[model samples]
Target: MSDASINASTVTTQTRVNEASFGDYFSLLKPRVMSLVVFTALVGLLAAPVPVHPFVGFCAILFIAIGGGASGALNMWWDADIDKVMKRTKGRPIPSGKVEAGEAMALGLALSGLSVIMLGLATNWFAGAFLGFTIFFYVVVYTMWLKRSTPQNIVIGGAAGAFPPVIGWVAATGSMTLEPWLMFALTFMWTPPHFWALALFMRSDYDDAGVPMLTVTHGRRATRWHILVYTALLALLAVGTAFSGIGGPIYLTVAVVMNALFLRGAWQIARRTEDDSEADNYKVERSFFKLSLLYLFLHFGAILAEALLKPYGLGGWS
Candidate 1:
């Protein structure tokens, strides 16, 4: 193209980018993801054996939420190019032309530094540093590197999301222990199956975007088998956590019921032929995807319930 056309194109892109409003900026932070981070972190904080000051606890959660937002912003900025092509992500702020890539990077960097420094001051440096590391892992390691490089991206990258609970535990007790790692493992192990279920139904998006999701690289059959395998392993861990002191009768019951249902869902997905799946338009896969959300939530909810009832001598293993 001529210099004039190039210049015009740049200006048009810039103008649209500059028109970003408050809501557009907010969308860059990935609010749905922020909610999950907040909920899981809150559970970790409350489930700790030590008590946290109310104000301090609130601040820790706030900063953690901000850090989670920072990661989302940076992720959007980096993934904007790919986001434009994928049906699932085409409407994101940067991809939709509502927010500038530079603006996203700036907001992400600002929030990352602010949240880390404030968290350290509000709680302890350890928790602060963990939050900082989580951001780095998500933005630099997972988003920039692993995402395009391999299908195991989400597998290894899931660690970034799993760290929140451990950070929350540290923020509350000023140290780490076995119990928080159980929470971490719960989310960590749960990540693969949860996401693989999504990849099953959303296969086209990954293929179109050239993303190396399990379904795209490993074939849907391999992906289904993977889901079933992970779900089985996840079931064993979930039920065993009940005997791990952090879980009680309530958690045990929830674990047994949920994991059983979860495994059955995985099995159904695994047993389906491509034709079988197409017959109902991936109904079982979609159900499993929805159920996966409820599955993690209820597990954490059960843990929270156990912790809340602990003071009343009504929670945990007797």
Candidate 2:
């Protein structure tokens, strides 16, 4: 082959190798996290006292999901460095080289603006503003600032994840109320314990990445204690939410059962020695982490069921 032709072929091959697939861009959104956001936000929207138009509700959720995706993109962009080192995050789009940091940033910014504007046009300015603030909190406050700085990172950063329900409620009602805040409280309180459980099992990832997770900063013993303490508080808040307007027999039942299992899990975790953890392959910690996922989902699912039954005066207790 001629030298020029050989050079052109090499350039084409390199370009093809560097090209990102559609799934690569989607992976930057952290779809797993976005699913939780969508579910909680939907429950909040449904649980509100005022009814919303179906089409408008759909638009609000769509925009909110987009805003969530934007946050994920921005988080990936900012955390690309640490992500590359963490075993858990090394495969993320940016860290794995499937997506560029610059591209993620631009996508984040663009979606951030688009979601906020569309939410406001579809619902209300308040909801739009809340969505915008959520994006900023997750991307700027949590990922950029708190994540690298403190053991309390997840504790404070949890608030950003907790805001979606409140924003959803606002999207439906155009105002704030105690009920939506209760939903926010549920998520906020659940965050520390949920994450601490994972940290117990995955401390190496944070340690290697140099992130100050409680497990790394305070040791596994302290992290276990933190999980127990937070789980107790989360139980209080979860059961209390059962008495709120969004709660009912169904929710109360779910709360009692779930909290019992959750407390048991936390207590078991607290009782475990590091030796025990090693012996059992961190089974207790891993189980608690898995349970935590269901704990939040069932709680919100009960809330949604209550809302669906409210029209028949069968929702909350009389």
- In the order shown, the candidates' Cα RMSDs to the true structure are 3.7, 1.0
Model 2 root mean square deviation, Cα atoms: 1.0
Q: Each candidate: what lDDT?
A: 0.93, 0.93
Worst 10 residues of 2 by lDDT: 91-100
Give the per-residue lDDT digits (tens) of candidate 1, residues 1-318.
999999999999888655788888888889998999999999999999999999999999999999999999999999998999998899898988777799999999999999999999999999999999999999999999999999999899998988888989999988988999999999999999989988888869989989999998989999999999999999999999998868999999999999999999999999999899989999999999999899989999999999999999999977
TM-score of each: 0.94, 0.98
Candidate 2, TM-score vs. the true structure? 0.98
Candidate 1 contains a number of clashing pairs equal to 0
Give candidate 2's whole-model lDDT.
0.93
